[model samples]
Target: MDITQTTSVATQAAASSADKSAAAISSDFETFLKMMTAQIENQDPLDPIDSADYAVQLATFSSVEQQVKTNDLLTALGTQMGGVGLTQAAQWVGMEARVAAPVKFSGDPITLSPNPVAAADEVNLIVKNSQGVEVQRQPISVSNETIEWSGVDRSGTPFVEDTYSFYIESKENGQVLATSTVEAYGQVTEARSQNGGTILVLAGGSEVDMASISAVRRVD
Candidate 1:
């Protein structure tokens, strides 16, 4: 018979139960009774099977029934936990986050994009360390959308790998012009099982899942 057509866990348990009942009472319980009677009639009557063996069969049936119910309960719990994880991912849609990152900033090839499109003259970028010390000053010549720097100092020396902010200025009179705007880039802080798998949103603008991440960083 087809064994997997049952609906509810109770129904599946019942079907398995019926199959076991059929095996326990193969052709008929009456046939077993009749055969036992005939065997008793033909035997010497002192070597008959003990009555306790039948009680053992009843105990086995009870154990199997309880096992099927327990399995069903566990399956339900797994489905519930998966739903809870998805809900947590939804809560991280707009939160700001910084992800794990291996920074690869070469002081010799540092370049930043142009903020104001119209002003395409020479702009100066001043690099300052965390202690507010002026470390490097270079003239960034802008012609198009981005300003490319050779990551060199005023004396044409390469910069060391560290966190620093730049102050862009007008190269004519050496006055500060435009400040920098840092953007957040990080991995998905959350995930969920949507139609099938999951969807994720980073701290910035990109919408990716748990799998699309290569690295994370918070560059200001």
Candidate 2:
């Protein structure tokens, strides 16, 4: 990932290319070994190159060869993972998704979708703040329906421009009933791997970790 490592990789790639281009490189490798052995065998009686020095070069070459192979395998695995993410992206096309985003206050009532499985009979929406404090609560009639928020706080004060969270609940006979789920909806712009997992980035500048996905649909 550093400059020196990148340069080393480039150098190794050039070496690999050269080795492949020289079709008889394996025979050449054997020839060099034989020549070295023959020279040592015929060396003068008084002077000889150190056999230990040749042994060191052989060891270094072996390590470098293995490293080049490892790099190639890793590059191949990355390509495979990218292909898998593309296949998964096609699964989320037409399904209605409930993404958690604050409804922009335009004086229009906010509408929530896909009612809770627990208490879908009498639905209610609870708005919470960043601190998880319930700032507003309103009773609604449908679980899988949408309700607009006027951006007003519990005391009927117009809320400021900031992010908020909402939870849909169902209550019957003054008792809690069920809870609904919320999901974000958008086209998958791209899929990428991060921290060993794939993430799908949607059209609204929001990112969804693949593990968080609950449903998928195909659309034209």
User: What is the C-alpha local distance difference test score of each model?
Assistant: 0.48, 0.58
Candidates' RMSD to native: 17.3, 9.9
Q: Model 1 residue 199 lDDT?
A: 58
* Reference-based lDDT, residue 118, model 2: 54
> lDDT: which candidate is best?
2
**What would the per-residue lDDT of candidate 2 be over residues 102-129, giving only the tens digit for each residue?**
3233343443554565534666777775
Q: Name model 1 segments beyond 4 Å from true.
A: 1-48, 97-190, 194-220
- How do the residues 97-183 of candidate 1 rate in per-residue lDDT, one tens digit apiece? 332221123353434443432443566566665455777666655533445545566676777755454555553344444554322
lDDT at 89, model 1: 53
Q: Estimate each model's TM-score.
A: 0.32, 0.45
Worst 10 residues of 1 by lDDT: 1-10
Backbone clash pairs for candidate 1 read 107-151, 108-150, 108-151
